[model samples]
Target: MRHRLAELRGPGVPAKALDARALAALAANPGCGRRALLDGAGVDKASLAERLGAPAPFGQSQFALTRGNAFEARVKADGGAELLRLAHEALDRGAEPPARARLPDLTATGPEGRAARTALALREATAEAGSWTLLDHPMLALEVAGSPAFLEPDAVVVHPDGRWTVVEIKSFPMLDGAADAAKVGAAARQAAVYVLALERVAAHLAGPPEGPAGAGAPRVRHRVLLVCPKDFSNLPAASAVDVRRQRAVTARQLARLTRVEDIAAALPEGVCFSPELPPEELTAAVEAVPAAYAPECLATCELAFHCRGRSRAAGAVTPLGRPVRAELGGLTTVDDVLAAARGEAGDPDDPVVAALRRAATLREQALREAAEVAACR
Candidate 1:
């Protein structure tokens, strides 16, 4: 499977590692087979989009990156004493104050080694009974579409009761005890991926004899701590975000995704997505895999622009938005929708067709009334 993925990514091309953000986005749009297959193969979608003449417009500025890094550093300073305190206040109020906690060294050679070390640390922390253990930038592994994706959360804290909580640090300001809802939601989704990865580790530690949530197994908390700057100051503020829904949705989507090997087997021979390939060939390679395009994808996917262009060219009503497409009901193209609205086609008994005709009549009446008023004036 790995060899096949490598071939799809092109000979001698290094595959891009999938991060928590990418995994969250993939989970949010599970119906997009193109994204699932490309991501599973570790293909760089940004580069692919660039070659296809629709470069992705989403990226953080260098200044924003620097500020974010500084904020994260401050939050994690002093062996993460401040971070632990915030976690206690936000998620474990009744427990003993985190005046002192253990910060284990998770440094290792590579991702696999780090993941192993993290698993070991979690086990040790769970065994400590009444101690608080903080792991900074712990590496975790989660399988998506039959591929292993390594995720590193900002921090993971093991509570006295053997409960593990994920901590997300961001530079976005939390004013009046609230941050931007969209940013917070994105953070929650990203953290949900971490929580899911932690559960996999916990399950492994529990073994098959004992179920994942067995007595001795580590417990992954569904509520993750979101730490961000407070108001206009650089001070850190914490909020507990419930991610049970996001975790459940992501888990289900991942479970139902088509395996990378299966998608690869169905592709034509000699198809590759290397940016070095000719433009036409690269386009062909991308088009080989069907995409579920929606306007919502513009914010999350690097290949959204390319997919949007194709969707519009094919007259797919999906570009109008998912909700609009749903309301259109079986009207998959703009031409079909217009024909229905004009009463030239479609079954008159159909509720959707009747609604379209009524809407068209109202629109025409409004336009006519405005024109008549203007002419009178």
Candidate 2:
């Protein structure tokens, strides 16, 4: 499978590693087979979009990146004293303070090694009983579409009672004990991915269900700590977000994704998504996989522009948005909907067709009334 994925990514092109944010976005749009296959194969969608003459319009400025890094550094400074304190306050209020918490050395040779080390650390920390353990930038592995994606959360806090909480550090400001809802929601979804990854490790440590319930196993807290700057100041603030719902949704969506091997097998003999391919050839290769395009993808997907252009050219109603597409039923194109509305095509018994015709008649009546008013004037 790895070899096949490498081939799809083209000769000598390094595959881009999938991060938590990308995984979260992908989970949010699980019906997009194109994204699933491209991400599964580790193809660089940004580069692909550039080659296709539809570059993504949005990216963080270098200044914003530097500021974010600086804020994160400050939050994690002093051996994570502030971070741990915030976690304790938000998620583990009744536990002992995080003064002199253990900051284990999590450095390892590679992602696999780091993941193994993190799992070991988690086990050890769980055994300690009443001490707080803080793991900074811990590497975790989650399988998506039959591929292993390594995710590194900002931090993971081990509570006194063997509960683990994922920490997310951001530079976004929190005003009046609140942050932007959309940004916070995105962070929550990203944190939920980390929580899911932690659960995998916890499950492995617990092993199979021995009796009625797994006893004394490390528990992953559904509420994650979100750390950000407070009230237009550089000072840090933290909020505990409940991610149980997000975690469940993401897990379900990830499970529903089509396996990379299956998508690859259905493609033509010599299809590759390499950005180096000729423009026409590359376009053809990408078009081979069906994409569930929606306007919401514009913010999250680098290939959204290209996909949007294709959807518009094909007269696909999906570009109007998911709700509109869903309400259209069997009518997938603008022409089909328009024809049905005009009573030129479609069965009269079909509820959707009848509704369209009724809407069309009402629209015509309104237009006629407006024209009469204008003529009177």
Candidate 3:
């Protein structure tokens, strides 16, 4: 299966490994088995999507990546002086500014080695109670759908009082003391993944499970520091965002994502996701894996348009949105919905059917009234 997935990358194009943001977005639409299987197998979804005639703009340009890195560097300049100062001012003004913060080396060969290094750094930072420690680009591992996902947060701060904070530095500006709400929400979701990963690490650490002052017991605070450019300036400003609810929801959803092994076990015989296959073959292979397409997937999933085309062609009710689909009862397709609306099928007494009939009648009356008014005019 690994070999088969490797072949799906088209001989040279590297597989787009799932990142924290991708995983979070996958969780945002948790109803797609197609997405789960492809993502878990590290399939080149964008390639498949292109073959299916819907090329998603998921590729981040190197210039944008470099610009983001530069922005983060400017914010974390001078040994993270501005970041920590903003953190203090935003989170705890009473606490004195951190002097002489420790920056540990988290360099390692791979995600596994980096995660181990990060854990070690956290432990050592926790032990030193008199000073502050900043972990930059710390790789944290999370178990998602029975697989390990490595997440690197912008920075993690271990305060003197035995508390840890997640610092999220974004290139987006905090204009007029506020940032884009949607962007902030996305950042919060990404940070929530980090917080959950840290909690998993904390759960395995030694000591009384809860260290002195409950430090050992998952010291990750729910309120994380979100630093962005202050009103178009290169200087960064920070705001404390409480992601407790998002954390709980994301943690639950991540755990509930269908495991790749199970999805593979259920695949039809002789179906491979090789990118070398013809477009028709690829489409057939993808279609074999069922998907729950929704309107929300347009902004997130690469395969959304492919799935949507299939759904619309099949008249599947899900493409119209979940609420409309829910009101349809067992009618899971557009044809069924139309049949009910036209009084050609379904029990008239059924609430869904009855509501549809009433809606249809109202629409007909409104149209007739408008026509009559036009004729009179």
TM-score of each: 0.94, 0.97, 0.94
Write the number of the candidate with greater TM-score, choosing between 2 and 3.
2
Q: RMSD per prediction, one decimal? A: 2.5, 2.2, 2.1
lDDT of candidates 1 onward, in order: 0.91, 0.91, 0.82
What value does the lDDT take at residue 170 in candidate 1? 93
Cα deviation at 310, candidate 3, in Å, is 1.3
Residue 175's lDDT within candidate 1 is: 98
Q: Which stretches of candidate 3 lie over 4 Å from their true place?
A: 1-15, 59-63, 208-217
Measured on C-alpha atoms, candidate 3 has an lDDT of: 0.82
Candidate 2: segments with Cα more than 4 A from true spot: 207-218
43-108 per-residue lDDT for model 1 (tens digits): 999999999999988879999999999999999999889999999899888888888899989999
List runs of model 1 lying over 4 Å from the truth. Answer: 207-218
- Clashing residue pairs found in predicted model 3: 8-275
Full-model lDDT, candidate 1: 0.91
lDDT of 3 at 38: 83
Model 1 pairs in collision: none
